[model samples]
Target chain A: MGKTYALTGNPNSGKTTIFNELTGATQYVGNWSGVTVEKKEGTIKNSDIQVVDLPGIYSMSSNSLDEVIALNYITKDKPDGIINVVSASNLQRNLYLTLQLLEMKVPVTLILNMMDEVKRRKINIDHLKLAQILSLRIIPTGADDRKELKNIKDTLTLDEVSNFNRFSYFSEDVQKAINELAQKLRETEHRLENDIHWLALKILEHDREIIERIKIINLGAVELGYKLRDEIQKQTKMELPEILAKQRYDYLREISEQVIEDLDKSLVTETVTDKIDKVLTHRILAIPLFLTIMLMVYYVTITGLGDKTIAFMEWLVGDVITKTVIAGLNTVGASEMVVSLVVDGIIGGVGAVVVFVPQIMILFFFIAILEDSGYMARIAFVMDKIFKKFGLSGKSVIPMLVGSGCSVPGIMATRTLENERDRKLTIILTPFISCGAKLPVYLLFAAAFFPSNSHIIVFSLYLLGILVAILSGVILSKLRYRGEDSDFILELPPYRIPRLKNVAIRMWDKAKDFLSKAGTVIFAASVILWFAQSFDFSFSRVVEPSDSMLASFGKLIAPVFSPLGFGDWITSVAFITGFAAKEIVISTLSVLHGVSEGALVTSLQNIYSPLSAYSFMAFILLASPCFAAISVMKRELNSWRETGFAVLYQTSVAYLISMLIYQVGSLII
Target chain B: MTIVDLKPGQSGQILELNLSTKIKNKLLELGLTPGASVMFVRTAPLGDPINIKVRGFNLGIRREIAQGITLK
Candidate 1:
């Protein structure tokens, strides 16, 4: 059996980097908070020891969700040992969390990371003395270095374990008070006798949640906790929690002064981050620079190497594979209906969306680079000044940015928001940011309607999405979510060169997810839609598609959308199928019109004028997200009523916007 | 004066904390205790969230919360 250990640390302390190096797992590592909301486990390479990467936390106070998660895992799962990863670059703050872990009495090995950065600042740590003082084995290693991984593995292999002398951080009077409370706690029916010290400390601090838990153990524990809290407050002339925190800080400072040495000018040099931020976060240049970078990403994906790769896939799936499959079926005496179903319906429908995978991959690649290199935090920081004016928290920037890739995880990311109003407002406005699933719809229309200026048109669509989101956020915040704005506390991590391997892993993961969806949901939806389009109400095959069941159903809803200008049964059916998944909009059109890969624009031109086509694209861009995203929204919001409201609002807004654009464009054109 | 009053490239010692219990606890957890020397780094481009260096790390916080930190 493999021994299990939990790896824990402060946010951006290089915990995930060490986990990746030790386990060879390609987990996503970003340079900000809320990156790892869930605990992930992997087996160590060449050993049976399993390492669990707990979410980064500041302390074991259990105030936030991430801290609660880490604390609960330590107390409940009770891993065999803990690898306490601390940052050498910021030892004072990082050591506070390490001390808390030590107070839990869990066996811990300290891994001092970012030693390279520390050294560059002319700071030196006496690791031997520090380890002796803390009574733990300490190893200094850079996050990207592999040499110390073997040392960690070897340390985990040790069999003998002994309790170290517990350091008392509190004053003698406070210790006396804790001892009395601890003794009372032990005499009661409390099941936490083993953690009496921790319980007594929590009681003194009046940690509300901990007090409640202690009440279950023994009602007397609650009364005793209140008494201790009042007594501590009187004695210290400060809040109980603050008093305890200050004591720990004093202890940490004492150890830090003895064990760490820094040159006189360690804090005075113009660091690399300072030089870079002066320009990147400049007052006059930040917004325009951000826009230019985003424009370049879209331009390259649509017109550069991404386009070339997509063109090759188009030939392989649309022409070569389709032709060969139909010929083989004909030689084997397959019926014409079977050939049509296999070649035109199944292959043609799914192939049209599959060929665009290269472009999607390229887009995600750039997004991954931005996130990994720490620029995503800067974007949030820069946009917060604008987001605040609209009554949304700056934290909303994270969910919207993630929403660009997909809405499920994006909606889930709202867990980081402390205010309920901010979380809900963010959830409602998140889907307004054009997700990758909506890309195919925009590209299809851009190619058909705006050929030479496709890049700019698509870029404008993105800007329009942002505009709609801001307007809706403002309206909603005024009507329902009005209050004092939630505070934004963010960390701007030093930017690093994005690791190529990490970027490739992220891009591949996203592309593989898209391709897998194309094979499964898109394939099944295409076949079912083809059947519905091919059969009439009498259950007989129809010569004209207008006489089929799908057409009859589309005719029912087509008039409802006639005001938006694309009211044909075919386009209506495409919109209906699109609710299942966004990419199905393109596939449904190909199946309904019998158009192959390259002939879609010409076929669409017969049904829609360029002005109406743009309107249709606008509708698709703003409409309700796919069913999967809605289900996730329901789960995250935990309210069907709110989910229903979101979908209704989205579709209504899409309709109004599309109608306005089409009506005005028709007159002008 | 409060942290929000500090200009760019200035430093001060935190003298008092007068915020809600929740925000105060979070700041303490991040090593922003009273008497810690804090330097005002720079505001973001649009000048709402201000950066400060304390305990050898930079923290970016909005002006609303920064107003809670009284400094000398």
Candidate 2:
């Protein structure tokens, strides 16, 4: 059987980066915490070993949910070995976790990652001496450096030769208390033999999770632990956990003083961040600079260069595939129904949504660049004050920005928020941001109605989504999910050139997901929609879609939306199937209307006025997200009632806003 | 004085952490203990969340949390 190893480290310590390097995995590596909330497993390349990358954690103390996850998995799974990845640039703080892992007596190999950063600071770490001091294997590696892979593999696969030993950090009095507590724990109803010393220390430190985990109900042991903590407090003049943490740091500092040479203090004076922040985060220039950058991105993708590329793809799928498939079917003596289903229902329907692949890929590519380059965190930093006025934090911007690429990951990104109220509030508002799935709908309508000003029109729609989100956040904060605003304790990682391979990997993953969905869910939805539109309730063939079962269902809901204009059954069909996935709205229209790409835009013009079409698009933008997102909301919020509330709140807001826009727009135009 | 009172480019030693237990523990884990020297870097635009260099890394903390950190 392959040995299993747990990869653990502090957030932003390059743990996941090393994991990707070792396993050839393309896991998303953000320069922020909570990027990996759960354990991700992959096999090391060319080795019979499996590595599980745990979420970045500060320590085993379980202060946060991610910490609790990593702590629990490491202790319970009892992996064959643990690879503790540490950032060499931040050794003192990172090694606090290393000491705690050593106390657990697990076989560990320490990877001193980002050694190049340390070297750049002119710090010379005596790795041999440091390893000897700790009595464990240590590998000093840099970003993209796999030279130490052999050493890591050997250390992990080595048979136990009795080199492991547990270390102690507390003073003599605290040690006595731990021993007595361990003795008392052995006599209690619940006792953990192997971890008695660690448990005793945890109890002294008042770790609530650990106290509850082993079910130690000994009142005397607790009293002893408290007495010892009081004595330590008198001696150290600090809280128990802080006192212990300081001891670990003191130990690390001593080791560093001996082994590290000539660490340049001048590195602090040469910060590039100061110069960059002066312009990027300037008070008067920040927001406009952000807007200009975003507009430039949208212009290139939506109206400028992206449109031409998409037009070519459209010709390939809409004209080339449709005509060739129909001709082949005709020559093969297939029935007219088979020909229509194959040509119009299957190819044209899925192909309509597939034509926007270039634009979606471009959008995702830019987002991944922002994420990997560490600018997304700064965006949150600059936007926090404005968001605070809306009862949110600047941290909420990360989810909204990510949600633009897609809402599912956008909603999932809320895990990083420290408070439940902020997380739930962010989740509720994230769908309002037009995700990439909604971009196709915007592109379709914007190109047809406001061809000359498509860029401004689309940008306005995106701004409208943010406006609606802020308004809804204000209302919701006042009514429900109100609480003290959490602190914006975020780290601003230094900006680096985004790694090209990582960017390409992220783009490829997103494109593959979009295509697979087109082949499966969108394809199936199209076939079912075609059957409903082409046959009557009696299953008899019908020439007119209005004579079929779909129109009967559409008519029932069409009247409900007449107040916003475009109250036709065909439009109703698109809106109904859109709940499955937002892009399906365009697909359903193409299949049901039997119009190819550009012609569908003209066909839509005959159905509604430009003002009404804009209103319809607004409604689609603001309505509840696709079913996948709603269920993800249900899972994340973990309450059916709250999920239902989100859906109702979003749909109601969409209806009222669309009605207001359409009614006011009609009066002006 | 608290950390919030420090101007950019000024350095101060943490004298006490007057935060809640949970927040204090996190701060300690981040190497912001009493006696560790912390330097005020710069404020973000609008001057709410300020950056500080502690233990060889930059960390941004909000004004409210900074007010809770007594410094000398």
Most lDDT-accurate candidate: 2
- The TM-scores, one per candidate, come to 0.92, 0.92
**Which candidate has the highest DockQ of all?**
1
**TM score of chain A per candidate:** 0.91, 0.91
Query: Which window of 10 residues has the lowest lDDT sum in candidate 1 chain A?
Result: A28-37
Which pairs clash (backbone N, Cα, C closer than 3 Å) in model 1? none
Could you tell me the TM-score of chain B in model 2?
0.95
Candidate 2 lDDT over A1-669, as tens digits, reads: 899888999877877577877777624332213333334677887787888888888788877666777777776767887899988877777888888888876778899987877666567788888788888888889865669865677778873322534445566767777788888777763445346777788888787777676554666777777888888788877888887776677677677677777442632554565678778878788889888887777777676767787889988987788788888988999999998888778887788888888888898888888777777888888888888888887889988988988998789778777767888999999999999899889888888889898777788899999999999888888889766665577777666567676677668877887898899988999899889989999999899988999989999899988999978998988998999889999988887788776788888888888899889989999999999799879877878999999999999999999999999998898
Give i-RMS (Å) per prediction: 1.5, 1.9
Tens digits of per-residue lDDT for model 1, A1-669:
889898999877878677777777634332212333334677888888888888778888767666667776777778888998998877878999888777777788889998888777678888888888888888889745658767687887662232554438778867877778888888763467347776777777776657777787777877977887787688767887777787788788778888877422444455677778888888899889988887777778767776788789988998799889988998999998899888878897788778878877887788778877878778878888788888877778888877887776688778777666778888888888988778878877888888898887888888888999999988988987777566677777777677786677667867777888888888898888888888998889988888999999999999988999999999999998898888889889888887785798899888898788888988888999988788877866768998899899999999999999999988888
lDDT of 1 at A626: 88
TM-score, model 1, chain B versus true chain B = 0.93
Name the regions of candidate 2 deviating beyond 4 angstroms.
A25-39, A159-167, A187-194, A216-237, A263-269, A283-285
- List runs of model 1 lying over 4 Å from the truth: A25-39, A157-167, A187-194, A206-212, A263-269, A327-338, A537-539, A667-669
Question: How displaced is residue A516 in candidate 2, in Å?
Answer: 2.3
